[model samples]
Target chain A: MGILDTSPRVRAAALVAPPFLYALALLAFPLIAIIVISFWTQSGLALNRVFTLENYREIFSSPIYVWGNANRWGVLPLSLFVSATVTLVTVVLAYPIAYFVSFVVAPERKALWLFLITIPFWTSYLIRVFLWKVILGFNGVVNTGLQSLGVIEEPLSVLLYNLNSVIITLSHAYAVFAILPIYVALEKIDRSLLEASQDLGESRFSTFLRVTLPLSVPGIVGAVLIVFIPTIGDYVTPELMLGSGGRLMSNVIQTQFLQLNNWPLGAALSIITMLAVGIVSLVFILLNRRWLRGRA
Target chain B: MTYSPSAAPLIQLRDVHKHYGDYHALRGIDLEIKKGEFFSLLGPSGCGKTTLLRTIAGFEAPSSGSLTIDGRDMAGVAANHRPTNMVFQSYAIFPHLSVAENVGFGLRRDPRSKAEKARAVAESLEMVGLGGYGARAAHALSGGQRQRVALARALILKPKVLLLDEPLSALDKKMRETMQVELIKLQRNVGITFILVTHDQEEALIMSDRIAVMFEGNIAQMADPETMYRRPNSRRVAEFIGKMNLLPATAAMERNRIVVDVAGLGRGAIEPDQAPSGVQPGATTVGIRPETLSILFPGETTDRRLAAGTVDEVVYFGDMTYYDVRIPGVEQPLTISMKNLIGRPVLDVGAVTQVVWDERSLVVLSR
Candidate 1:
């Protein structure tokens, strides 16, 4: 009976309102607050409300006399490299597992297999990382086993407390995310296409090379994006398991906020890292699309 | 039929039975497809027509019996090594490749040079009437275009046999009809033995030179289109192929001509060949095709006998009208198809009409 009640625009707005309001309250507010704080000047023992670009200037350009040389090349790019490496390793390791579960495992057991894959998630994530630390520590199971086997006279110090350990820990932590997308992509492919390839006189390997591999690219790309974006900003894994040699972008930002007590510099660092990550991700996705389109 | 029976067999199956775990997919299939024949395995779903086709294509290995293709025993031969190509029901066109790449996919391991392979792909594409569409992505093509691409892709290998699993089923009605004729022409042009598996009896009749009608994993009747339509071996096959009016009758054999006492059309003598599976001593049924029975227009006369009936149902197609005429003693109405010629008028429902039928057109089926 009412005009607004019957209006499609009002109905659509009503449907969209909940998620939109939630996003505004949770995501946009913090992001805007950080951006605003990045421009405000903060002095020692007190906070100054003076608006200035000094925070951004310090983070973007090197103060030639700065004390910290570790981040002179910028922690964002190094953090990106670590995350990219972890994503590459995780995808390379996860792909075969995903392929095996999707194509090799029997249909009735598929749910059990997938459930097994997600079993690690039931435990707390921080506990999982510390478990990895225990597994790879200097006097950990691996080093102790090697020493007891007479392969080493003492426990080796090369296994933990480094970027390599962090990479291993992060890759293990994100295995499920990488496997799920690839499995879905592989599962979505029509089985008849494989039969068609075989009927067309292609060998098993050649069919995989020509048809199976190409069709599964979308899933692999999805896995890469899902694993890459979050691990770059992952603060806990590197913080608990690594020294400064493995410190990532989040660690640097955290130090600025907590220990150094420079909230403005921390906010500017966070914003710069977010922008760089966003731009790089956009470039990656665009390049993949163009390349995939051209190939197809 | 295009293929001469005396020609060397292209494919042969001897008691080919397939079982998928607990389900019997193919139960003792015995068939021989001659060279250059447009053969179709026609059946409803779950009748194992597709399973039989896959067995011939080497995608499925027969559980018990043996198969031979081109005089070679195909006992352990894998699908990739078999000299047979298939066009899937889904038209399984590779979505990630260009049209040219898809058409040339089978030539990847050929010893020929790049130029020769390219020429072969172009020629195959041209054969399917997709000549200049090589640079286009395969997934971007329309359904008809996709079927054409699938045909070209399968034919590029020049195999001894091409197994098509309902390739035109995905197309719209207009496209399906057009492709059916195109497919027949393509089969003749390539001169390769083509075995199509389809559930559409009309499609099977229109395209196949010879068809194998299967029911519950067994071939009910394998004959040329005309014979399959006119003289089906069983009542089930008769009803499956097209609308057949069946009347309960009593039959007794006298000499070569079997005397049948009918319920609707009156007693008459039918030829022994008309009783394909032999007439039983007890209850029997007589089948007549819709096109074989015609409704006589006012004042029209026929050399054949006549039966008076009332039109119970009238279904009008654009060029033809189907009239279900219930005769005096018949329980169900007999369907008579009348072509809507320029001057011939369409009959009305519940109208009194005279049905024209020939004794020779009746096929005696034993129950």
Candidate 2:
């Protein structure tokens, strides 16, 4: 009775309080901890607990922290390049499959096709990454098949333990994330719009370009963010296929925390990566504002 | 405007049939729409009116028949290549585009300058009464505005034939009526052949120069609106186009006339044209429109034949009131409509009355 007799505003706050506190405890507190630690100094076996900008200074001035060097690119820029490439490849490959499921498949069979798309997710992600290693390894199926067909004299050495392999693995791993949003977008399109496009003097391909593509921009934006954001911080693919060549920003952050015992530096780099992702995502959204916000 | 019967047909369909797997959608449709004619395919849902329109628009290819537009055979022609454009029932305005961009979309390949295209878009929007709305986002439009945009977009292409698939069905009744008048005016202004598909019979009757009443994938009857309404070829067509009261009767053909013994209303001699679906000498049903039968309100005099009846029910409309009168020997109560004019008192149930009906208004349908 006491709770029920409360004012409507108080009742509303009471209803919202549990999830808000849970989020503050699990999510916001850890983020706040990271922010506080990022400003601190770490000494051997102990945190100095004094606010300092030395970590940020090192990140900006250090040669190793540069995006690239004369011989090879640094981990930060390489990670950015790899994730961007992965995002592009996954989105491009996902679109036609999404289109097929949404438009070509019969209405009754659509659920089945969408369910089949999720079959890749049933296996453990690490197992999926390992499967990619097997597929793209030196003696893997592609190289062996080419060798068996006398198309190659030896297995290709460029297939694994590199950024290219990392990109390939991550692209395959996050393909479901790209496909789902795009499929939903394509599915939401009114079928009559295509006919209207054709009736308006557009050929089938031209209709796709003019009507279908423009209408699905929301889905494309969603798919781009879904595949792009978390992939920049992905740790599994680069670690599985390892070397200096395959190491990424996440790997460097892991080393600072585990090997160098410099939690503050690691936290600072983590914050920097988050900032980069936020900036990139914000810029991407701004670029697509005409498609996303204008019509909506 | 002025439609000449001798003018070559702008659109023609010969025995058009559409089969979606096993379900036959359009069956043996033969039609010709003349240039500058407002033609309608009127039917209930699933009667294949939309399918026939789609076939004409080149969205659906007929299974075993030929379609021609502007004297050219449409076989193997894609929708984009056809001289036709469609205003979809859903309006289908591209949500990502502005009103002007949507209207100008079909003009992409035109050799005109960009300024010319823009002018054409503005003109098209103005024609649809959305003149200054070109800058508005398409998605932000109301239902009626979206309809105008769709009409503008389709009309801007200036195709030889414009197909409207139940274009006004999405609007409210008043808005639909308003758009109907606007569409008729626009069609006259453009001089393009319009083939509309609709289930609303009143809309069809109001808009079409001629209407083909379809039922179960068949064109039951096709004629001018007045003929289709007054002399329906079958009881199905009669019941579909409007509220028709059918009385069981036996018709015998005399030379150039049908002598019908209509139950409850007694014997009448109708012209040969009144028996639209030719009458056999045996059993049949005669269709009477409610408006043609009026209750002889007190002091009303008419030379038409009268039948004694009791008012079983009364429904009051603002302008007209309908009475369901129970007549002797009639299977169902015969309905009579009366105008609520000055000095005419509204009749109540159980009031004794005489109903006036004309033999000229009777349509004899086969039993």
Candidate 3:
């Protein structure tokens, strides 16, 4: 009894209890409320609050629902596809930079290179995105440079107001999120392992393919999760820069609450989108664990 | 203790020198390692022993001179193309691979079937006494087992030479002693040139057939174990090898022989060969190992030179006892070890003692 009373476990629990309670009230309560509200119904401004499955039925059966849209063809799937593509491109682009930072830079200069990598983050994310908006917009940097060079007869309007521009902007905004984890994974590898591979008759390229690439999967998976999860539901980036044809699942969900005045439908759309993301994430983790844990 | 003269030299280094920016790592090293010889580069850390091993392994190229392995010049050859393999001091076992994969890592480019490669891995593992440990993760093994895995992996390729960098230093004393004997037997069984780099003097003495003792990027002395122990050429080499009590002496060459008078120990007439490096006029020293001088037992009759001393310090080991005796004229007390046999009394401090001296074992060194 004396040892138990003197132990730090009780004090640790007391210290952690505050943040745990805060998350419960702030995060968990709203999630549960969303699920509960998806099962309730609303009618015309003033209505009787009655529990029903109509909101889910409407989401599944109506043509105006996310999946039934003919041209956009389910903003849910489109958003998931866009986020996944951005994650892939960003990781492919940032891999070399992370590798260079971890291995190529001298030990004393590594801190300086990492600081340079993170310098873009000192500015606000919104401001960085807005700057990219200016660079990619019609009559922006690319069109102006091309026109002055006489390579283009007119300002290119196709560069902005498209899914390509939105993907580019999102990738730029989330570059730090992708680079840091990958850099950490690359840095965690021991130097002797690389030498051992070369000593065992592997070429530099094959050694990287077999050893360095396989061990960096955990970081790649981390970057994918970080970029994809938030980007799937990103409303502001699309609202500011996306063309009329580039509505994601979040835009329709926002419309349900603000214009449609149907909170139940909005909650239903959110629950559906969350389930899709969770399933995709779980599949990724299961595959990552199987491939990396078994081999690496 | 025997090196076969018929065995041809496998590695020849000629005036090899390596420099890193301002630091000279290896300075004009020239040596020849015979086929099937267990050679050692032994020194304290930063003596360029490891750099020399790396040069032989083709991981480092000498700055100016040339190195030839098995009669082929090794200039600009990568480690993968070289005929030598190294077991790193850290073992460098790939954690992500299995024991079998690690053992067969060098066989990836071999034009053999997978089954044949697997058999080779198994055979190498069994050779190192790690039989049937192929499927286990490399990171899961114990320290001794990891060392064995490293040995098996390096030896599996059957290179012309195998290099070990402080292989036994990571083990505890008992494990280290066991591995030392096992390593000697392994080298003999494999019958390749084994060059070990170690900072431990006793490990070098126990394991090497011939050792090149390095100091400050230069090989100070290269000799067989018995010669290194009995006849070190210089005072520095003698002190580095083991405990030696150096007595300031004056030597006079008379009739092709050197007559030396030690400060505390009496004079002796020694042959010319006893002074490996010819003794000169100025400050000369005669070295005697601790075991060469013994405290004669009471009532024992021996027709040998004797000295009188008082035991100044007593250190008792379970099997032997060391007595530090202060003779009248010696600057420092001479340490003598005696076996703790039955009925042989262990002397205490301040006890009067008789020391039996062997004049033939004395070495004249130039400091």
Candidate 4:
């Protein structure tokens, strides 16, 4: 008998087995290991392997400082704030570019416009982040250019080595993530809906607000989660740009595992960060569902 | 309702032209549509029928000439500012909105109270026979339901003109027929002028009081359904609107009457009105609809002109039977339609028969 004559259950198993097994091995296994380790106790140069609430107790009770900021409360909220700001900035900036590519570019030239938008990705992301470092440095591109143009009397020290520099770098680094999803959403919109809005007596701007924006909610949500989740745990931008001043949760987790030799503590921190990201993403998905009410 | 000659034209276009870069979409269109008239723009695709409708809706400005509605020139007005609404071909219902929200979309800028606008929305939905479907999601509705929602949304605005861009083309045959009757009834009840763009000639004939037949960016003919079907101005239009058997003929003007010698049906005198575009003495064509010609049974008799022919092909369509009758003189077989009744028979191919025709049914077209 041919493959088409097989039972639906057998066909479904054949179709789904590969990816399901791959995800189980690569994703679920590591997460399960981390969750188990989060509950174990860490001794000097050894792991007790005994279940204990000591790590959780210390995590909730202690107010230890990391680079002059509290590790538990201060650094976590700072990471969230920085990631939220970057997400807002990246999405807000990416929306107009996506809209231009989808609506303004001619049908034949749209591929060229999207290619140009993604040109930054041709280079390594780390290299792009280092380039932002060069651009935002005190004696770098922005300050020097402004001084040469007589717009500034001196180099501005406030341009780099702060939370702003980390935000600027991460926003630039994750720009393509925000832009691609938003562009796909905008492109999927039926152009007739815009004309219908105008026919219903709405201005072009109002039509964009009422029809185009709401229809692209899925893309916006996709972009938000894509940028927000990864940037919240980003260690590179904070370490490279902010120096020791504004280190994030990722830097602390790395310190525990590599420098402090606390595998159990690092695994616990990783679990907590994962849960935090999950909750925030869940909140965002819920908001997206609310925005997409009554839609197919 | 049909247009009245005495009333002032509600919308007038004086030599309107639209050019999209190198393509000439509309070429010097001059039109007048009266208020409360159910008018249609009918053509095959790329015939500039939709372009003319878009021009009236203020979506595309004419490259030249002036368009006016209610005596005001529509020069700089945008689509949103124009007193016109459209039901898009795809229905274009806002997928994110409920039925009520979509119907009330145009009322965003209205000065009325919120309750009054809500009531207007409800009433508009009721008019389109979607009264209790307000809370339903627009994207969840079927094709016919979405069409009704689109109609309700546009009609809620109560604009001077309602533009429909092939609104019924997406529905199934039965649903399209149902909507056609509903649209006619709605237009009558609302008293708003509806300008429908359609490629389906039958739908235009059934729905429109007057139809403008377009071909290659030009208006070929504009008349009521009966006049359009009976006295099409050109051979192309006659072929486009319905099935017309164009027989080769020669015509000569004798005083006021035109004499045409059809290849198969012989010579006959025709009135001036039989040749809508005016007949010149030369080789021409004469068109006659299939139903206008009949086949005589053995026991039947008629006062009409008769010719001896053999049935070449037969197609039975339940209630009617079409036969291709080949006469001795005509090169192409002429199709004749006959209704199947209690006593009539479906003729078989190769059967010898007498085809009945009339001189009054001849429409002469210049070659």
Candidate 5:
């Protein structure tokens, strides 16, 4: 007999089957195909169906490919480092704002502040990035104002086309994404818990650190994933702000896929990047679980 | 750790006024609670009982008056710094912690070592009758168990005062009764002042040494439970606290005495001493508790028995029988209750009976 022998069970399975099949076809099947192709080889001017490790060997053997691959490897750790820094800064900055909106602001005015925070995103993303570029450029507004104010005699060359500009632009763009989830988490927290903490003789700072921060971890995790995952795969902000020297893994994948026509190699690099991000996310989930269990 | 027998009032609120925008939440409340008395602020919803409790707990700042604890002014004291704790109505157990951690949360702030904190947590759990359940998560506990954990959390602090905001309202009837008895014993054991806010009059009368009845942002009366129930100062208090059958009456001064002619019961002279402060000679209202009225047999003396009424409905409540008597000329029928000692109901439906209550039971209030 099938597992759905009961009527209710069959009905439930029927209800769930469409979404499950769609996820398998759209998400799981493509991911598996990409992973399989990452290990295959392609011949000159045509596709090779043969399974081989030549692409992997080519990636590891040549000095330029090796250096470029090593540089690609640098994107993983560097992106993670940048993302972590941005996540920390975002959390620290967003918490008090979320706290104020949730606890202090009147219910009517809370929506206004939240709307103001989101208004920046109504403008075009490309325009916002370009605005940052104009502001941070060598002879842009910042330099012109600095020169006019006599802070420096000439425009500073290190202000644009660097890692600092990439981090700054990405952090500013993704801050709203981080704030919304954290604010939701803060709002869902029971006000009685805060009152209980106060009644139990905990100082406001202690209550926030011990109770509010820990309870809002789900929102923090969501914010971290939302900001970090996209920032890792982001090409536009870094491309616009960092110029050619500060290209990330996404830029390299774009070049290999479109410019060089090395479909298999680009696919391999894409799979590698996906695998790296997956591992980091899995580690975070496991760590969060362990911390929660330990606290419990 | 022993308090002096003649120790001063642990909590004192004088002319405390709390105004939220234009609405007055607490109006010029003055109260003093003794060191170890189990005091209750009892009222219906929105009558400022909870506001008064929160003000005493330092959660609110009284607008126009002084609040002191242990003879020290509590003007700028925050809730965390005050030597008091509260058991919230919702229990508010930290869902992320174990029962042990929830109980020991406040104690962990002390300079005690980890072992001392653990011991304190264990002791508190044991005191609340959850001796070996410290490792259980707070969410895993039942409602009554969560209430115990809340009480333990507040009591573990050993504060000078413990405030409870409708602590027993969430429990079922059986659990509520058991918790009331256990709380009284616990208060006696701890010997700390407990100020509770509750809308349940029976719960207040059962557990508190003194009860303050609040009405519309003001304390209408404060006295022992017996006096507050028997000699309520106003009609609102008599109606709000318990079951009272209020009958409209016309008062007249006759032979230097105030005589009130009730609608159903004929004219009876009210003792001038028992008349309320603002009683006029023309119109008034008289309050009588349901239990005070009794059905008299035919041969019984008719001295206090003034009227005959037909029984409209008889409600058998297992321990007592409530009879709704339909008396003539009264808009609302009067209720009378009799104890069901031998499983016998008080009166049959549609049966005519004489309703009698002693003169002392007739509490007259002026309109």
Candidate 6:
């Protein structure tokens, strides 16, 4: 009679219907549409009613497609490696800053440091990448100044339009992305735990390793996922800093969708990219859970 | 029981002064703690009892003066390097570690192989009565078990002294009492000097061999628990340590005896042979513990001692009965507590009764 006494079937249906409808309208329908279009012939009459693997086979067999696939796979590992290296470097640099902010700086001045770290993010992302370009270009300020100061005889050719340039530019642009989560984790740790660690006969370095580092794994995981996942699919930084040789999967997807005028292949490529990212992220989540469980 | 006293005190704090900016946190404090003694620093919040414990643990360096443990100066020594460990009020168990891991944290740094570490961990766990709980996460343990883990962790290091910062305040009443007895047994078994900081007077009185009563960042008195309860040195200590009835009195010398006149009661002088030293002839306060006062029936006046009063209020605790007696001309009512031996309550409200106490039970306090 009352809402609390509602039947189980009705209650379950009531709880699930709205979200299911929203997902169908927003996500599942679009995905089904893409998959349906990926199998269509040139006439667009859905004549290939039988589900066929031709679209995938054609993309995998062609040389250009193969090269694109190779480039995509190549960028996947390279981007992940670059992101990991940048995360490690950022953590090494940000840890002391975070420690200083948490322990040395007065509470009143902490907001100032946070604001300074966040000020760069307020600027346009593209403009920041462009500024890095101006600074790292052949005739840019860094090369001219180094040449004038007699630090170098010629402008450095490796500073731009390559894998290193993309990595450097992306690292600089997303440095705060790594710092904020780690800072939040450090802030949430109890101060009494530190004192207890000291009172329990642990040296400062040992305490940091045993207590502080293990506790910050969640934040470190977040930082890695935030930087690595996005960087794998990024086209802007690589396109602006590196030319065709450094182009990633996102760039190829863009070309297939717009320049090649092949919607079905583009859809297939998009699905493949999604699958790769999903698999990598799933693996990372599983590993992180295991590590946390072991620690716990 | 054939324990030998150490040649020097296990812990000695000499002329210790600590200041936080302009606020003086600890005055010049000198204390000597013998080996295997259970000492307590008892005070209200902000009374600097915790600061003294922290200073002993080497967490907070004293602003001035010297601290020595076992004849070694503690200057510039960090907490990890000191010969003392503390059980924090919060217990401070590592939520990520298991119960055994929490207990063995201090011993992990020992120069031992993995098997040895595991053995030590098992031993400590067994010592804390949690033998088979090595794999239980700390968060899964109850509060009492967590407290035991903290104790085992501190004791595993074999420190010269163990400091507890209100460690039992987090437990419920029944658990606290159980832990108190267990702690006493553990201390006796371990034979280490244990210093506890607490604001609970009953806890200090029950567990400590000696209690140092602190007030306003200074120690008011220090003595054995019985002496501290019976003869507190100052009015502040008398009020802080236990319940006392303070009555206004004027003192005068008569026949070499110290005479005192309570406001409502007639004048009486302490016998010259039994008078305290420095009993000046002037106005003073007389203090008597509530339990020392006895109620007598009407027409039961004694020769020189009994005082008659009307019972204003009676509180019936399960174990004891408390009465607030208002005598004529006395501005404040006198409190008296009697053990509830009989099945019936002692007196009804508004009943007239004579209150009597031994002359020696009265403590005359100077301003």
Any residue pairs clashing in model 1, and if so which? Answer: none
Instruction: Kindly report which residue stretches of model 1 are placed more than 4 angstroms away from their true locations once superposed.
Output: A1-22, A39-41, A47-74, A243-246, A294-296, B341-345
Q: Residue B174 lDDT in model 1?
A: 93
Off by over 4 Å in 3: A1-10, A46-48, A62-71, A294-296, B1-3
Interface RMSD of 3: 1.7
A82-130 per-residue lDDT for model 1 (tens digits): 8999999999999999999999999999999999999999999999998
Candidate 3 per-residue C-alpha lDDT over B1-367 given as tens digits, one digit per residue, 9 for 90 to 100: 2357467889999999999999999999999999989999999999999999988877788999988998999998888788888898889888778899889988988899999999999999999899999999888899999999999998888888989999999999999999999999988888888999999989999999999999999999999988988899999899999888888889987777788988877888887767898888656899999988999888787889899999999999989998899999987999888889898998879999788897797899975
- Candidate 2 clash pair list: none
How far residue A69's Cα lies from its native spot in candidate 6, in Å, is 11
Please, what are the lDDT tens digits per residue for candidate 1 over residues B223-339? 999899988999899999988889898888777558888787877888888899888766889998899889999867778888899999999999899999999988888989999
For model 3, what is the error of residue A153's alpha carbon versus the real structure, in angstroms, after optimal superposition?
2.2
**TM-score of every prediction relative to native:** 0.93, 0.96, 0.95, 0.95, 0.91, 0.90
lDDT of 6 by residue, B66-144 (tens): 9999989999999999999889998988887888888888876699898988888888778878889889888788999
Q: Report the Cα interface RMSD of each model, rounded to 1 decimal.
A: 1.6, 1.1, 1.7, 1.0, 2.1, 1.8
lDDT of each: 0.88, 0.90, 0.87, 0.90, 0.84, 0.81
**DockQ of every candidate structure:** 0.65, 0.81, 0.57, 0.83, 0.57, 0.58
CA error at residue B352 for candidate 6, angstroms: 1.6
User: What proportion of the true contacts does each candidate reproduce?
Assistant: 0.78, 0.88, 0.44, 0.94, 0.70, 0.62
- Please tell me which model should have the higher TM-score, number 4 or number 5: 4
Cα deviation of B71 in candidate 6 (Å)? 0.5
Give the per-residue lDDT digits (tens) of candidate 4, residues A1-296.
87668999988988899999999999999989888888987788888899987787767665542222433446666688889999999999999989998999999999998788788889987888789888989889999999999999989988899888988899888998999999999999999999999988888999999999988989999999999999998888888888766568898889998999888888887887888889999998998787776684
Displacement of residue A45 (Cα, Å) in model 6 is 14
- Candidate 4, residues B231-332, lDDT tens digits: the string is 999999999988899999999877867899998788899988899998889899999999999999989989988889999999999999989999998888
Q: Could you tell me which 10 consecutive residues in candidate 4 chain B have the lowest summed lDDT?
A: B1-10
User: Quick one: how many clashes does candidate 3 have?
Assistant: 0
Task: Estimate the TM-score for candidate 1.
Answer: 0.93
